[model samples]
Each structure stands twice: as C-alpha cells, then as structure tokens.
Target chain A: MRWINVLPGVLVTFALLLPAPAAAKTELYSALGEEAGISRLMETFLLEIAADERIVEHFIDTDIERLHRLLTEQICELVGGPCVYSGEDMVTVHTGMGISHAEFNALVENLMTAMDAEGIPVGAQNQLLALLAEMHPEVVKL
Target chain B: MHTNKFVGVALAGLALAVVQPVYADQGRFIATGAATTIDGAGGGGIVPWATLSSYAEEGQWGATASLTEVNVDDFALSVSAASLTFDNRFEFSIARQRFDLSTIGGELEQDIIGVKTRLYGDLIYGDLPQISAGIQYKKNRRFDLPSAVGAVDDSGLDYYVSAAKAWLDGPFHRTWLANVTLRATRANQTGLLGFGGDQNDDYKLMTEAAVGMFINRHWAVGMEYKQKPNNLSFADEQHWRDYFVAYFPTKSVALVAAYADLGSIAGLDAQEGIYVSLQATF
Candidate 1:
C-alpha cells in the first residue's frame, strides 16, 4: 500500500476547504448584477418553471406575479444584495405542497438554466446554488 | 455464454419489476451519480463511491444500462452492467465481466449482483457526508484458470462502506467530489481469477478512494485507486489506479474515458490500458 495514505490526506483537505459562502456574499451579489439582474434572472427562472411540465403543476394555482416578486427578493437577500426578502418562509410556503425530490431537482435545473441564460459565471452560479440547495430539506419534507 | 444479452435482459427485467411500484425519472442533478464500476457498483471505474447510480432522487426509480471496455497490454476486459436506483436510497445492480487474456488465449468470466443502501446524510448537503453500505456477490463461470493458479473458490462476497462529499464551490470554485471506501474481500483480481488462494484465504480489508471535479455541468475529470489483497501466491497482485474524464451530455446519457494502470495481472507487470464506457440513465 505505497499510496494507501494519500486518500486520507486528500479527504481531510476537501473537508477543511469547504468554502465560507458568507465571506463572498456581497461580491457574489454584485456578480449577479444586483437587484435588477436578479429580477431579470427571476423572470427567466419563472418562465422555465412555467414551461416545464414536471414542476409547473405545483405553481399552477399560485399567483405568478407575486411569486415572481418574492423570488426576486428572496434571491436578492440570499446573495447579500440590498433588497430584503418579504416572502413566507420556505417550510411555511411549501408545507402542504407534497413536493417530491424529483420535482425539487427539476426546479433546480430550471434555475440553473435560467442562470446560464443570464450569463452568470459558473463560480457565481455555484455559490448561489449552494445557498439555494440548503432549502431542499425545507421544500421537500420527505 | 452470451454475456451482453444476459446482463442486459436481467437488468432490464429487474428494473421493470420495480417500475410499477414507483415513479421513475431523472430526478437528481446532472453528474451527481457515480459512474458504474467494473464490479457493477456505482462509483468510479475501479472504486465504488457512496453516491448511488443514476438520477433517481427520493420517491423515484432511476435505471441505467452501461457498457465498458478495457483493452490492456496482456488482457482485454469487457463489462456489461445495469442498475436500478430507488427512492435515492437503494441501488440494485447487475454486471457481467469478461476478462480476455490476450497473451494466454483464454478468457475468464463472472456475473456479479450488488445491492447498496444509503446509510446517512446527503452527498451535497449539510454537515455530514453521504455514507453508504453495499455488498457484491460474484460467481465465476470459468473456474479452470483460477483453480490452476491456486485459487481456492469459484465464488466470493465483498462488503464495503463508503463516504462521499461534494463542495459546490471548491478548488477553482468548481464543484468537487471526494470519496473513500473500505471493503472486506478475498476475491482475486476482483473475482475474475477467482476467490481466495494459497497465500491468503481469509477476507482482508482494502481501502479505495476517488476524487474529481465537475469542470462544468457537462464534463468532469477524476482519478481512482483501489487496493487489492495478495490472495494468490502464484502472482503478487498490486493495487490499481486510473484517471478518467466523464461527459454527461444530459441527465439521460453519460460517457467515460480513462487510462488505467492495473499494475500486474497473473505475473504480468505494468498492465496498462484504455478504458471507455457508455451509460444511459432512465
């Protein structure tokens, strides 16, 4: 086992290097082009959700206009932008939705597509994804 | 005798058997699942990771079919594999491994059935890394070569526990994945040359690891190392390693290319090769 000891070292490194998303929040917020950019991104993301049949059913009865505003504000606050989120909490909003993991993932992919369309850098996109992925437990109770 | 058809039909049947009970879809994110290993486990080419196969998230069934080829200096190996993942937690896999001895002019074959279950945590989320426990049951169809080479058994079982983690913003701010696995086994040359031997008949604990980063949503590159036990005295087996590039064009299809250094095979040294695999996820 000449190289047997290498993996533990690498695993420890990966563990220790888990980035602090808070450290780069404002910079990331700026990278997402601030509130206007986020608003544009939200528009694109909602359009994607509207088009995708897998997840569209979840939002059919909701208010798209208010949902758009709330998403924009939520993302703005999450990225450390100036705007504050005024929407209901994730669990509260999603409590009775019965959202499955597949639907959650589908929406995440749509958001990724939206970010790509917005021309967000991969690094910035990942940063945002890390923040949003945290809501998975809250959104999909199962 | 017909390894391809056998594995394909068996795997597909297993998947369809479970289809009526669960909704199947590409639920997980792209490249989140590990590639199918030669041993028919979900992981890198040689080492199994904690991540399950395919894009099956919770409450979904994800099925896949894969074909892999390894052309080495002394041997050419082909593996036909398929797996079904359910509820993002359990994986059932089957594979047919054919090891062709290019120099010896004979071939060795085996069929493997594996089951893996997620024990705790999420691969990309929270404080703990994703952890899983699995077992592979391997039965060698052609045992003559193994028997002649001091192998003691025609079949064996391997049990393993693995932990894996991913950082969305890692080195270079790209998504990175790392995994470590510990396996207990007595299989010789991953069971193609049989199980147990004159040198060691008891199961030994072996460590395997894999690490890689997704350069983007569509492409990833990584490397793996698998430690093997020296069960047979006739040929001193060395560990195996490989560096691989994986491409996931969509959630439904994946392709992997790798350069493997198998170290030694039945007294043959420096057995290196090119490994290519194609996988389809449903």
Candidate 2:
C-alpha cells in the first residue's frame, strides 16, 4: 500500500527504458549445443589458444588432450549440462602456473574470438565468460 | 571568470595522463561501470550510480578526468572534474562548474568536492545490488545575485546513497544496468543557485535512477532521471532527465553525448539542450 503511488512510476520507467526481456526457452547448456556442441567449441578454442603467442609458452608442458577433455567436461557441467567435472579445481590445477593478468586477458580474448567463429550467441558467450571470471582468483598466480 | 580553476584542472589531468599505470589484479569485466557522470561520479550521463569510476579491480588504484559541456536554450554550463578511486572502494573527486546565463548576460560558478565509499555488495558478481554512500560539499563563488533572489546560503552539502545492479546477458544477449539513489539535499538547481531558500530550508529526500544497456563490449546507451527539491519560491524547480549514448574506444578513454532536459532553472522553462563529455581513466 505504501508503494502504490510510486509503483506506477517505476513500472512505466522500467518498461520504457529496458529492452524487452528475452524468452526463457533454452538453458545455457542447450544454447551452446549441450555436450557435442561444447566439444566442437572447445576444439576451436584450444586451437586458437595454441596459436596465441602470449600464452602459448605457458602451455608447453601441459597435456593438450587431457586439457581439452577436462575443459569440455568443466564447461559442460558449468553451463547446466549433465556432464560431471572430474578435473582438479582451478586453484589446484593453476597454482604456481605463473599466470599474469595480461596472459589471462589474452586467453579471454582468444576464447571470445573462438566463440564468434563457432557462431555462439553473444549472450551465451558472455554468460560463459561471467562464469569463468569467478575463477580468476584461483587461476592468476601473479 | 575563474579561468585559473579550469587551467588547473586541465594541467592536473595532463600530468595524470603521462603516468603509466601498473595494474595489480585484473579484476572485473571490461566495460563494466566504465562511464563517468557529469558530476564526476561513476555512472550514466546525468545520475551517479554505485559503481566505481573505472575498471580498476580490488586493490588497484583508478583515476578519471572529464570535461563536460551542456548548452541549454538560454544558458551554457561547463564542468571540469577529476576523481581518484582506490581499491574499487573509495572515491574522491573535485569539480568546477561555470554557468553562463546567456539570456540574462551573467554567469554563476561553483566548486564541489565529493567523497564516496562502497558499503556493501558487488555490482556484477552477486544477487544484491552494489551500494555506496557519498557526500558532496559545494560552494558557490558568484552568489551575490542568487542571495538577492531569495537564496539562503552560498554553501551546502549533499548526502546520497546509491544502489546499482547489473544483469549480464539477461535479456536479448545484452548487458543491462539499473541504479537507484536517494539523496538528502537543500541545494537549489543542484547548487548553481546555492542552498536553501526563503520558502524552504530543510533537506529534502530526492530519488534518482539510471537504466542502461551495453550495446556491445565498448558501447552503452541509457537514460537517467534525477528529482530536485524546489526550495526557492521565486522560480519553481523541476526534475532533470537525459537520454545518453556512451562509447569507450579504449579501456582508458570514454565519450558521452546526451539530450538533457533541465526543466526550469531560475525562471527559464524547458531548458533543454545537448550534453557532451569526454573522460579518460587509468
């Protein structure tokens, strides 16, 4: 009752200012094509990362096949897919890895480019990036 | 004409421009709460939000400098400001404004010093809105006419609390940001006409809001509305609103343009015009 007078103002402003809300028809996982689609996305992402000179040296000792499999599983689970992530947590896997801020940003840039090339929607791509952003503390050693 | 204050701000900004920033934690997303408001706060064109001025993450220092010009139908106002944010938590700012009443053939000037601190929540990472509290201390330099026209004082302080929330890719694959603020103030015409008046002297609670959407990583479009307190009886004061577009070509530089409606100032009705600002941060 106390908010009745102001409610109309708020509603009208929100309606006029915001874009129309998107329908909730698809989960984030489904938007990225579930497991099979994730695999292809990971393939493109990994290939681009390999070619990136800024972060390539850090991956010299990494196991590419294992890394790819774990990435696919991790992403699949993170995005509401059914896959289970059996890989080590970000901190355990990345501690002492000497990851710098520039390297991390470069990695994200490569990931974004790969997503664009793979036809991933901008929303899905940003969602994925948001989830990954939480892992920065664990991944960045410096 | 207070040309020295303008030159001082410009020189300080130039000095800051030459210092190379050393980033600590590359925290926060790109283009997150990156625009600077006309009042030297982090936000949209007209209203201040709860976000920090720039992309500086926790434990990092960020500084921003901006110059803004607003040309209304009967007047022209220019603001020069600079702000320093520390650890994405505390913000300190100083701004000088020169208002030229072209129609009246006179000018009014004011200096504002402000401090803001984040109290709780995060703008992007959590369910709760980011909240901040701030105080702006304003002093009018040219107030002889304002005092004669029923203004009670030439100096006043404004206190405000703001909340900002960001939803990433929540709708239409675009990031949306919404902010609300409650300010307690006695300033008339946002302090250009000084504080308090013959009709009313008590501080009034005012509401302001800003809603925006990120067009992409480097561009944003938004609208803002700020309520004002009508303290002076000589001329009825009105709320302010603007539709704005902000572009960030690089992480350090941002440009904003808007169409602002300042309602009534002094006695001029429908003071509508163009607003443009340039800001650089590191």
Candidate 3:
C-alpha cells in the first residue's frame, strides 16, 4: 500500500545487479621499479660491500656496472621474467676466492639490507635468495 | 611364518613396554640437546633432515628420551637415547644402542655422547632459516654374547653440519621445508642413525636430504633420503630411504608413522616394513 516501500525494494534489486568487487591478486615480484628497482638495489648492495673493509678486496678491479646488469638479468630470470643470464657459473666465478662462510654470510646480510631499503617484501626477498643459495657450496669453502 | 609372527609380537610387546613409561604428561626424563626430530618424527628440536636448530630463547631447556627397535628375521636392534639442551642453542645427548644377531648369535652395544651447536638461522626463518653443526663421540660398552661375527668395535666419532630453509608461501609455502646435511663418521654402522656397518669400511661420507610439509600446526608429513657407504664384509649395505608422517598435539607430545624401504639387510633385497614412534618432550 506504500509506494516508498516499493522504491526501497527497487533500489536493493539494482544494487544486487551491480558487478561484485574484484579480488586482490598476489604479485610474484615487488611492484617498485621491478627491473630498475632490482638493479638499484643490487647497486646499493655492491656499494655496501665495497665500503666494508672486511670484504672490499673480493671485488677489487671489478666492473660494478657490468655486475649490476648481470645480476639484474639473473634476478629477472629467477623471478619468471623474460631474461637470460650469461654470467659466469657460480662456482667458476667464486673459485679460488678463499671465501670463508663468514664472508659469504656477510654478503648475504648486505644484500638483505639493500633489498629492505628498496622496500622489497620479506617474502620476495626470500624467494630471490633461495634461488641464489644453491651457490653456497661453490661460494663458501668452509 | 608362525615364528616370524611370534617374534613380531614379542618385539611389539617390547616396544610397548619401553615407550609406556615415558608417556607421562610431565617430569619424565627426555632427550634434550641433540636434534629432537632428527628421527623424522616431529617433536621438539630439528632432526638432521628437518630444519636446523632454531633453539628457543636463553635459559629455556629441552630434554627428550627415545626408544627405537628394529627387528629382522635374524637380527634385532634396540636403541635408547637421552639428551639435554641449554638455551635451546646448545645440546648434549647420550644414547645406547644394542644389536643382536641370530646368525651370529651375539649382541653388541655402544654408548654415544654428543653436543650440538646452532650456527645461524632459525628453524622457520623469515628470510633464511638457521644452520647448525653437531658432533658425537661414541664409546663402546663392553658386553659378551655368542661371538660368530668377528670382533666388533663400539667406540667412534661422528660429525655433521647442515643448512635448512623454510618457505612461508611459494610453490612450497609454510608447508614446505628443505634441508641438506653432510655427515662424516668412522662408526661401523649407522646403528640408530638409520644406516649400519663396521668402523673402517663403515666409516662414511654421507648426505641426508629431506622435504616436509605441515598439514596443520600439529601434523606434518615428510620424506628422508640418506646416502651412505657400503662397508661390510658380512653383507652389502644398501642406501636408506624412508617416508614418515608425524602428529603433534602439542610441542611436548608427538607420534610418528613411517614405512621404511630398507633396501638390503644381510644381502636381502627390499627389506621393507612399517615403523611407529611415540615421544614426549620436556
């Protein structure tokens, strides 16, 4: 008997017909700069190592720019992007460095810090490191 | 078949008797320091194949006691271990294992004492789980049995170091964990460690790897593959492989169910059987 009551029902019907809200998708990699961001993070990581007196000698005479490119390519390949890494095999690159487990661990810590500074989520950081950890036996002698 | 059945029943009774006393809710002595779940039955500390030691905070101590029995047609093994941990980071353990062989009609026993240190990382790390190292010195206990197999030595030293990683989410997720352990030892056999043989030829450069998934907080399923040397004059030893499922209603109570495919024992192929374990931790 009330036209106002019918109007409310009509509004409810209209609302039900509208599309539902979309669900959020899980991202595989960080949204920040993706490639560029990763490159910058790697640069910062190398810089930290360069500044550390304990490990600076390992990268003496090294080309930071080329290392950055190769590392970026490697990360991209590992994170499901379209990139091929032509860098030296992990064992070959680290051969005869006499790198101790402590040094390798220090490098890992530096990388983690750099990743944090770039705002990479903890999950993504771990995912990236897991791909690289297979080199432990080759990189650390003891 | 009847004799084998009778032996099985006897072994089952022994297992029941050995495990029942340790089932009390509290104040029962338990193995503390060494890896708690090293046997693939989830309980407290990490097993060799599970994640490494992420011992709890300082002054938190853990102790555990375990009994294991392995029986075949001609041989039987009984192993008991007690260990203590300090600060969840350092552990000391003592274990005794006895082997009785019908073919030789003799029994051998050994006492093992060891210490473990958590090097780095946690059991379930946010980024990279922890890594740890352990070394055990085994002293042979003197005993006399029917001597048919040559004189057996009971004392030896063994060492192992391992690294592990846990994933919160990925293809593996929180349910997925991986570990690799390198062990060097001069012991004649794996004894209770899962493989067996003599001290010299039995000394092994071994590797153990495992992957586990927690179905829920209180339950987990995992598989362990161990590679060891075949060093026995009496019989050729086969590599060890086992798949196990564990139930933990609480951190202090656990039960493990496993089916072991023990490749060869005394030159027999495919010595497979089921294993069950119940453990209480304090």
Q: Please state the Cα-based DockQ of model 3 relative to the true two-chain complex.
A: 0.02
Give the runs in model 3 whose Cα sits over 4 Å from its true position. Answer: A1-142, B1-55, B71-74, B102-105, B142-152, B170-174, B191-203
- Cα deviation at B47, candidate 1, in Å, is 1.2
Model 1: residues with Cα > 4 Å off, grouped in runs: A1-23, B1-24
What DockQ would candidate 1 receive versus the native complex? Answer: 0.50
Candidate 3 chain A, run of 10 with poorest lDDT: A17-26
Per-candidate interface C-alpha RMSD?
A: 2.4, 5.5, 19.7
Candidate 3, lDDT over the whole model: 0.55
Per-residue alpha-carbon lDDT of candidate 3 for residues B2-67, written as tens digits (9 for 90 to 100): 346435544553455344332222211111111244332222222363232222334455565665
The sequence of per-residue lDDT tens digits that candidate 3 reaches over residues A10-100 is 4323332433222111244444256777678878888888886657888888898898899888776666666789898778888788886
TM-score of chain A of 2: 0.81
Report the number of the highest-lDDT candidate. 1
Ranking by TM-score: 1, 2, 3
Q: lDDT tens string, model 2, B1-282?
A: 334544544455455545564543334556664666666777777777898887665666778888887888998888888989877789888888999989988899999998889999877655568999999999999899789889999999999999887776556667777888899999998999989999999999999888788877777887788889999999999888888888765556667778898888889998998887778776
TM-score between model 1 and native:
0.91
